[model samples]
Target: MIIRNLADRNKKGADTEVVDGQQRLTTIYEFTQGGFSINDELSKRIVRDNSDSYEFDIANNAGKETEAIKFYKKFKKGQKVSLTYGTLSSLMKADFDSYNMALTYISHHDDNVIAEYFRFVQNQERLRAGEIINSIPDSLLEQYLMQVDSKSLLFKLSWEDKRKEFDKLFYAAIGIFDEKLPLGGVDSDIIEYVKNSAGIAGRALERTNLLITQLQALSKDETWNFSSGINKRFVKFLCMLCGYGYVDFSKNPKEKLQQLFVVNKKLSAFSSAKATALSNEFVGYTEEQIENYRLIALISKGSQKWDMVEERMRLLAVLMNEVKI
Candidate 1:
C-alpha cells in the first residue's frame, strides 16, 4: 500500500514516480471491480446475471467478461476467485474484517528520493526499511553499500532478493565497527557513513570478498555457499576484523575460516521457521541451541536494542576464537 505523490512534479530532472506492491494492489482493486469469485456457496449467494436484482449498469452490459462469467470459469477449475454484489444490502450480508490502509508518502523531486524509495519498496518485508537508507542521497558510503549488495561476491552468496537482507548485515557490520548501533537499525550516524565513510566500509567489503573467494577455492564443492545466519554473522565478523586490521587475510586465512565454518556445514533449514510462533527452527539444532536465539523481540519491535546484536556478534567472535578481535 504505497505510492508517490507526483502532483508537483512538472519539473524535468525527477520524473520517475515511485509505486510499490503493484501485484498486490492490482488483485485487491480487481476484486472491488467484481473481477473474481470466492466459492461455490458464495457464488450461489451472489446476484444472478439474469436476475432483475442485478443493478449496476455494467451488469446490463452482457458479454464482455463479467464477474459472473469469471465465476463460472473458476468454478470449472475447482478454485474460487472471490465475489461481487449487485447492491449494498448484499455486500453488508458478508462477514469481513475492516482494515485501514496506511500509506507512506514520498513527494521529493530529487533522484535520491526516487532511488531511496525504490530501495525501501524493494526491501519491504515490509520493504520499508531496506529503502529508507537508500533514499539518503548519494553518499560515497551509500554508493559503496549498494555496490557491495549488487557486486561483492561475498554478499551475493546470500542472494538477497531486493529485500535488503544484505544491507541489514552490512549495517550491523558497520555498527559493530563503530560500536554505535542505534535503537532502529540505521540512524543519522549510520546514514552519514553511508554517505561518506571515506571508503572504509568499501575496503572492508572488498577484503571480505577476497577471503570468501579463497575459501571457495579451498572447497571441493563448486557450489559451496557461505550464506547462513551463522555464516553471515561470521562474514560480518571478518569485516569487523578487516576494518580494524585485526585479522590478516594475507597468510593462509582459509584454514581459520574453515575452522569457523566447517567445510561440510549443511546450512539448509528443515523448515521455514514460522516467524509468528517465536521460532528459530532449523535442522539438527538442540533445544538449547534454538533457545539461544536472542533479541527476537527486537526483531518484531521496531526500535532494536543494539546491545543484544552486539552480544550476538561477540559470541560469534568467541566461537571463531578470534581473541585478536
Candidate 2:
C-alpha cells in the first residue's frame, strides 16, 4: 500500500528512487506500469487522494482552470483524463550520472571521507542483506589503501590513478592472492608473515578496507610501481624470498641495504660468479637490504612499454631459477 502511494507520488513529481527499499519500489513500479488494479483498500485510498492532487496540479500547469470544470464533468462521466507525468527515464538517467559524478568528485576532493562513507554504508543493517555482497570487499580494499602513508616510497613510485593496481600487487606480493584465494593455512601463513614484518597483524587486516578506494581511482591506462612498472616484479620476488624465512644478517639495516647496490652491480655483469655472490649476499643481507633487493628485482623485471610488465615477471622468474641453481 505504501509502495503504491510512493509510486503515485513519483508520477506526481515527487522524488522516489528507493535507495533503501529498491525491491519493494521495483515491485510497485511493475504493478503500476502493468496496470494492475489495487485491491488493498488502504492503498486504493492513498492512490486516489494522490492521483486527484496530481490531476489538479497538471490542470493548473496547463493553464486550463476554466477547462478543469469541463474535465471534472467529463471525469464524472467516467471519461479517461490525461495527466502529464514527468519524464521518468530521463530523470533517472540524469540522477544516476549525477550520483556517479558526485562520487568521483568527492573521492578526488577527499578520499578519506569517501572511504569512511562507504564503510558506514556497508555496515548498515539493511545493506548487509542485499544482493551486492561483493561490493563490501571492494569498499574495504579502497579504505585500506587510502589510509596508507602517502609519504611512503611505494606511494611515491605509484601513479595516482593506479592505486588499486598497486593495492592488488601489494596484496599478491604478501601472498593474499585474489578474492578466490582460500583463507586457510596458506592464508594464515601469509598473514602471519606480514604481521611479523610490520609488527602489527591487526592493522594489516584493517588495511584491506582501502582496496575499493584505490580501484575507484583507476584509469584505463594508468600504471603503479608494483603492478605495471618495475616495482611490481621486484616486490613479488622479494616476497617469495621473505616467504622462505630469510632474515637480515647485517647488524645495521642501512648497511645491509648498501649491499644491494653491490649485488645490483654484480648482477649487471650477469656471470656465474655473480650468481654465487647473490646467494652468498642473500644469506647475510639485512631486512633493509631485502627491501632494496626487491626494488632492484622490480627494476630488472620492468619495461617502458605497458605490455612488458608481465614479460619482466617471466624474465625475472628465469633469472631467479638460474640464481637459485
Candidate 3:
C-alpha cells in the first residue's frame, strides 16, 4: 500500500490520504476481522462431514448475538444451515500480530528534496520572516526602517532568514524606545505605531539605524549575530542608542572600542563578575558611568516585563555614543 502526505489537500482537512491498494487491503482487513464468508469459488469445497458443527455456521460464527438473533428471525425455527470451506478448522482464528504491512510512502516533498543541489538554496515559494516583513505595505515606521541588504555582512550572520527574529526585534525596539508604551509589540504594531505615536517612532528608527550602521562597522566580532533569543550580543546597544538624543558626547568617553569593538564588553555580558569586565574594572570611567553600567545590569534582569522595558532602554541609551574609537 502507498500513502500520501498532503499539506494543502482539501479533503476534509486530512493530512494523509490513501493513494493505492485500498480495495485489496480493505478486503483483506475485513476478512482478517471475520467479516465475510468465503464462497465456493474462493474455497476448494464445502466441508460436508462437519457441516453440522458451529464452526460451519458462517452467519452467527463471529460470536455476535445481534447477528445470530437477526439470522434466527429471518429464517424458520432451527432451519439455519451451517456451511464451512473444505477442511476449515474454525471461524475465529486470526492473529493480528502475525501480519506486517510494508509501506511505500509518497508525498509532495519527494519532488522538493534536491539531493544534488548547490551549497545553499532559498525557496522563494515559501515566504520567510524577512520577506513577510518586506511584504508589509507602506507604514510610517516601515518607511523609516533601516535598509539592510541581503548581500550585506550583517545579513550573512543570520544565513537563512530566521522565522520572525527580525520582526520581533524591530517591533520590540519601536514599542519600547519610540512608542514609550508598556506593551510589547508585534508585526501589526508597525502600522499601529505610525497611527498613534505622533512622530516619536519615526524619528527613533531614523536615528537608530544610523547608530546601528556605525556599530556594525565598529564591532570586532565579525559574526555579531544580534537576532533575538540567539547570540543577542548587541541588544543593549539598541536599548541605549536612542538615549544619545538627550545626552552630549563631547566628553569623549575615557573608554574605547578596542580593535574595532563597539559596545563595552561589560555591558554586553552583564553581572558575570570578572568573566564580563571588558576593559578591566570599568577603569577610567567616572562614578556616574559606573553606576549606569551596574544599574543597567539590574534593570535588564526584568527587561522582558513591559513595565521595565522603557526604564531599561532609557538606562542603556546613556551607554551608547560613548564608545571612544
Candidate 4:
C-alpha cells in the first residue's frame, strides 16, 4: 500500500492519503465489519499454530474482536504509515554502548584511520558551525568580524579532502622532523599547533578559499576541470603546500598557478595511464607517498576511493620540486 498527502479538505491541511490499493483497503474494512468469519476448523488450527517457520502471526484469528483486529492492521509498510502520528521529539539518542563500540573499533584501527575519523567528526562539527555562522546577520558580522571576509566566506571539506590534509600534515611533519612521532597523524607538532588554535577548521576553509581565489585570479583557463577528478585534488594539495610554506604563494602567485596546471595535467594523464605503476613506484617512500600509494592501489583495485585525494597530493610533492616557485 502507498500513502500520500491527503488533499487539504476544509482547508485545514491534510494528515494523510492512500495513494494505492484502495480496493484492498475496502475489502479489509468490510472484513472487519463482517466480524472476521472463518471455518471452526481453520480458527482452531490458527489458534494452535505456533511454529516459528511460519511468516505471519496466527494469533489474530477469526475469534479476535473486529475492533482489535482492525487496530492491529493499522501498521502498514513504509514511511507514510509511520507518519500517522509524527512526534517532534528526538528519535535517536547517543548512549554509552555506542560510544564503547566506537572506542573498541578505533582501538583496532591504525593511526591513519584514527586521524581520518577524528578529522571527519571535527569537519561535521565545523559544517554545523558554519551553517550557524552563515545564518547570522551580515550586520552583526560586520560589527564583530576580525579577519578578512573570514566570517562571510567558508570552505566545504569532504571526508576525503580532510583525510588528505591530515595525511599531508602527518607526512610533512615526519619529513621535516626526520623522526616519526608517537602517533603518525596526531603526535606532530605542526598538527598540534593547528589543533590548539581557536578556529582550526575555519582556518583550513579560509586558506582553501584563498588558494582558489588566487588560482582563479591567475588565469581563466578552462582546460582543466577543478571541481572533480584529479584537478580538484591538485588544487587542494597546492593549498596545503602553501599553508605549510612549501610553495611560496606570495612570491609568484601566477607562476605557481601555471605550474599547478601543468603538474595537474601530467598527474591526470599518469593516473589514467599508469595507476598501478604509480602505486608500485611510490611504495617504501615517505609516509605521504606510501599513504597516497595505498590510495592509488585502492583505485587500481577497483575500490571506490575518496576524491583522488591521495594521488593528487602525491603528485604535488613529486612535481613541486621540478616546478620553480
Q: 187, model 2: CA deviation in Å?
A: 19
Runs in model 2 lying further than 4 Å from the true structure: 1-139, 142-147, 155-165, 174-230, 238-253, 258-325
Ranking by TM-score: 1, 3, 4, 2
Best by TM-score: 1
lDDT of 4 by residue, 1-325 (tens): 4333333433555555443457767765654355345444443333223121011122424364343233224322111212111110011001111111101112223446445544655576645433332211222122212322221121211124443343333233222222222212222233333333333235434444454453333334323323333333453455445433446655555566567655555433323322244344443457464444333323322212233433444455555455555
Better of 2 and 3 by lDDT: 3
- Candidate 1 achieves a global lDDT of 0.43
Q: How would you encode candidate 3's per-residue C-alpha lDDT over 1-325 as one tens digit per residue?
A: 5455676865598887666679978887776566766654323223332232222245434755444334333332334334222223332121122233544344444423422111122443333323322323344555434443323433534424542344444445655555453332323444345445544545555555654454334232353343333233343333344333333221221232231124345654333323224346576988577667755544443224444655655555546546544
Summarize candidate 2's per-residue lDDT along 183-278 as a digit string, tens digits: 111322333343344322342343233322232232211332332343333333333232222322112323322332244444422222222434
Candidates in order have lDDT scores of 0.43, 0.35, 0.42, 0.35
RMSD of each: 16.2, 25.7, 24.9, 22.6
Lowest lDDT 10-mer window, candidate 2? 100-109
- Which residue segments of model 3 deviate by more than 4 Å? 1-146, 150-153, 156-163, 180-230, 239-264, 268-270, 273-289, 304-325
Residue 315: error of model 4 in Å? 8.4
